[model samples]
Target: MAFQEETLNLQMKYFVLVKPSNSTPSCILSLSTIDNRDIYNNLCQTVHVYRSSPIHDSDSSFDIFHVLKEALSKALCYYYPLAGKLVESADDGKRRVHCNPNAENYGVPFLEATANCTLSSLHYLDNNDLEIAKYLVFDPQDKSYPLVFKVTKFLCGGFTIGMGVLHAVCDGFGASQFLKSIVELSRGRTEPSVIPVWERERLVGSITKQPFPKSPMNNVAFSPFLNETSSTVIKKYCFKVEGEMIRRLKMSLRKENENLGFTTFEALAGFVWRSRARALKLNNNGETMLSVLVGMRRNLKDFEPLPKGYYGNSCVDANLVLKVSELNERPLYEIVKLIKETKNVGSTSEYVKNSIDTWETNGKESLKMKSGGAVTVLTEWRHLGFLNENVEFGGNEVVNVVPAPCNLFASVDMSIFTSSNKFDDENDPSMKGGVNLFTSLPVDAMPRFKEEIESLRFLS
Candidate 1:
């Protein structure tokens, strides 16, 4: 199939306000302190692309919009909080959801659109043209609604389901649960497999309002917000690290410490961090940091596990700080060990509680990065289940899933995605295993970044 090199034109048809089929309670849902962080003050958008199957093409009377709208209504009946309004408290700046019973006031925005080109032309949304993203997702100017969706059909009969959800409402895991509810209903399921539990109070019950000291090592920093004033142009690039390469990297790391077994994330994130630091050519004496989200849902030494259906911002920040010289000079295995240790510490019950308390007390102002340090934020979406096989449209599973071009996370230094044969040609071995890495860097620095990562291909 010939792919189009230019951006495809999209026409927005109409928008519908979708509400829950069943009535829900009218109340205010309080957001956890973690959810009120400055970092999550924006929207998170993603697109799930589905190809035209024989069944969809053969049925002339089938309307994708109608099917989805019905499923959405069903989904909202269960996860009604998502269909509510995101409002702010007048007394304090904290955000909460006001679940108004009226449909006109609480409905989520749903849009219908059509694209001039086929999914193949856009390389299943793998193209570099960021312009294509504008039409794929609906971005509301105000935070009135907690969620917004757009369903764009391609000329070739393929369609993409795009969503924009307020990050403060839920983390990736929570969003995935809500998405699964819709998918299950769309597939004729009466209800979602896992019932959602609203337990924000459980996570934030213990509040110690005290200021915490800053990291003694000036080398460590939280990932910085985008530098709008910088003259350098940033470009996004996608690279694939084959499964064999990852195995080799992990094997090599294991040789350093036979007892220390490194998972794919530990080894890969460490490798990317080192590669980025080297590519940027930072001063050896300067500090470079790797920031990652550590999941806090598991059973800790002193804390019970969070309920299975409890989907909130149950994650803590974990940063691995190192001197540039040490990072570049140390063996890859040692760096992987450091990554593993950072995660271990960050996942502990005491550490998680302290981090939450510190964030709650310090407020958003204290969430700034140091003035003179390079930071890379790594988010693992491969295991997020955004592209689960069960999430199908018209009996066909989605072929590709991509974050909206406007996503703030996309502006970060690096993001990792699941590798799937479905994303590309099934015959292609490279897409079947390993992970896909999306990287953003200064235009001039990308080539060096690519070079640094490319060396991993021959690690074995």
Candidate 2:
């Protein structure tokens, strides 16, 4: 595919402050767990596009902006913490949500804009054009707000919704729940089906002081705040892996190890891990790591499973490290085994409980995991329901979902987000019920990485 320059005449139309419709008490909401502080600097932004609704008359009487604004206001009543601002606590110097029910600081930042292009025009945008899409979303540098929203209307009547939520406020799953509620309200629903729960302190419980576990991968000394320089340029790539190909890969692995019952996620991640190590040309003895984000909501044994509406960070990072030569020479099944074992260690209910206990006792200063060296962070967002949310604007449901660029974070060697294919051709084997990998790599190594990924298709 050839890269084409596409211009989007995007202009900010208006800024709406979405406040809660019902009154609530004023107080500060403390982030109960230290895990919330881990992603204080990361911006989780998502963009969804919908085709123009056919219900509008020839006069274009359907006003989407007004409807969305009103619906969002109603949704804020239940998910009121989203309408609050992030402020530093004077005592602990930690950030917490200041939910002043008072009129001054109790509204979410919502921006409305228009563009000259249609949803089809966005087809020209590839992995490299993610910066353009990121600009369409609201990103606050000062960390003043927990949530910011942007809506862009196209000339062809299609529109795109861009959301930028601080990771400290909620993970992707939590954000989806909030968005679904907004959709329901937009469709004229009286109230949200699920009420949000905010018992973070009780769910996490008290911290217990104990010796931190010793793990080489988690003991890295790198920090994102440090100034680092390198000749490698950061670039992004996107690829579609067919469901059939994934099945074949898993089958081959299972044949080698009868006990191997890996999901598509494990199979694909193994391939990427090996391929990336080869492409980077790291020293044989150098350490290469793969970090996976494991959710703790369902894995908590001590506490009941988090409620459907618990909008907070409840994920723990698990890391698997191996010598570069071992990764390259090992069979694919072996790599899959390593990935599975790491997941098992992280997915255990006890592991999550211990993590919370440790973090609570030591606070943010005790976080040991650091991103640097040859580490690649993989986040699986396939089940987040980005496409199935039924988010309708002007009677049109969301047709496409595009994640923001991963190139902004330079400290990490690579960042990968995997999602189900949104645009697949009927005849294309690689596109049928497949997975799409949105990845970022150092520019100097991307060419070699592309070669490795392409080789996997034939090898499978």
Candidate 3:
């Protein structure tokens, strides 16, 4: 299929300040204990792209911009913190949400624009052309609003909604919940099904009187942003791994070792880790590490499952270290075992509680420390309800959803597995039920990495 590259002529229609319809009290909201403040300190934005179905002339009266603005106002009433601005705290010098109920700083910035090109014309675009995607959303460094949105109307009567939310306010899950509420309201729902909870203090309680021992994990420094020179060339690649291929890979691993039982995430992550290790060609003595974000909402034993409305950073980082030589020589099952074991440790409530306690005791100094060695970070975004929402902008359901790469954590190599859409053919290489891997690597290493990934299909 020939893909056309068309210029999108976007003209700003108007800037709307979406405030909560109901009044809210003024206050400052602090980061939760589990919130990795140091890592997300940069002014990076998480962009979500949604493509809408074609709008017919019969529905010309349906004004998408007005509907979104009204629904957003209602949604902000429930998720007021998002509507607030991020201001640095006087005492700690850390940024916190200043949630004032008045209209001044409490409204989110919403931009409505019209584009000359249709959404279909941009189907050829992918992660490699992220600039196009970035242009669809608000400025990443724009700190005026914690959440900003841009709706672009296409000439073909289709539209796209791009949302840019600061990483400091909430994680992807929290952001998705907030977006879902807006969609529900847009659909004429009286009330949002899931309310938002803002009790971050409960997650990260006050410090204890006695000094706690420093955690071993704090020994390494934590550098989330990479020092980029003019010569540094970072490129992103998106690859789709079908469910059949994933199942076969896991089956092969279990066949090699009868005791192995790895989930799709573990198996795929291990495959990517091993491939990268080989591509980088690290020395036998050198270490290769895999870091993953583990959610603690349902796993916390001390507290009941976090309320449906609970919206905060309720996750911790887990790592697996292995010698490069061992990683290359061992069977895939062994690597899967290592990943499974490491993730299991962080799966428990006790583990998450202890991690928070350690962070509280160590304070900012420990948080500033970067990891000792280079590690590859993998963030899984599957089943986060990005496409499941009933998002209608005067048309049918969302046709395509693309999550832009998070540039904040640009220090180490990063890979994100976003959800995929369905294709017609079951055996089609681009079939649905697959995961789209958005990855970044040095220009020199990417060729070898791509080769390694392509060889997965031949796995026996």
Best candidate (score: lDDT): 1
Worst 10 residues of 1 by lDDT: 219-228
Across 364-411, the per-residue lDDT of candidate 3 in tens digits comes to 754343332246788888767776645444355564566554465645
**Candidate 2 has which clashing residue pairs, if any?**
none
Worst 10 residues of 3 by lDDT: 218-227
lDDT of 2 by residue, 390-439 (tens): 65554676766777663233344545555553456434566566787777
Per-prediction tally of clashes:
0, 0, 6
What TM-score would every model get versus the actual structure?
0.91, 0.89, 0.87
Ranking by lDDT: 1, 2, 3
With a 3 Å backbone cut-off (N, CA, C), the pairs that clash in candidate 3 are 220-370, 221-369, 221-370, 221-371, 222-369, 222-370
Looking at model 3, residue 137 earns an lDDT score of: 66
Question: In angstroms, how far off is 365's CA in candidate 3?
Answer: 2.1
Candidate 2: C-alpha lDDT: 0.70
lDDT of each model, Cα atoms only?
A: 0.76, 0.70, 0.69
Report how far off residue 412 is in candidate 1 (Å). Answer: 2.8
- Between prediction 1 and prediction 3, the one with superior TM-score is 1
**CA shift at 170, candidate 2, in angstroms?**
0.9
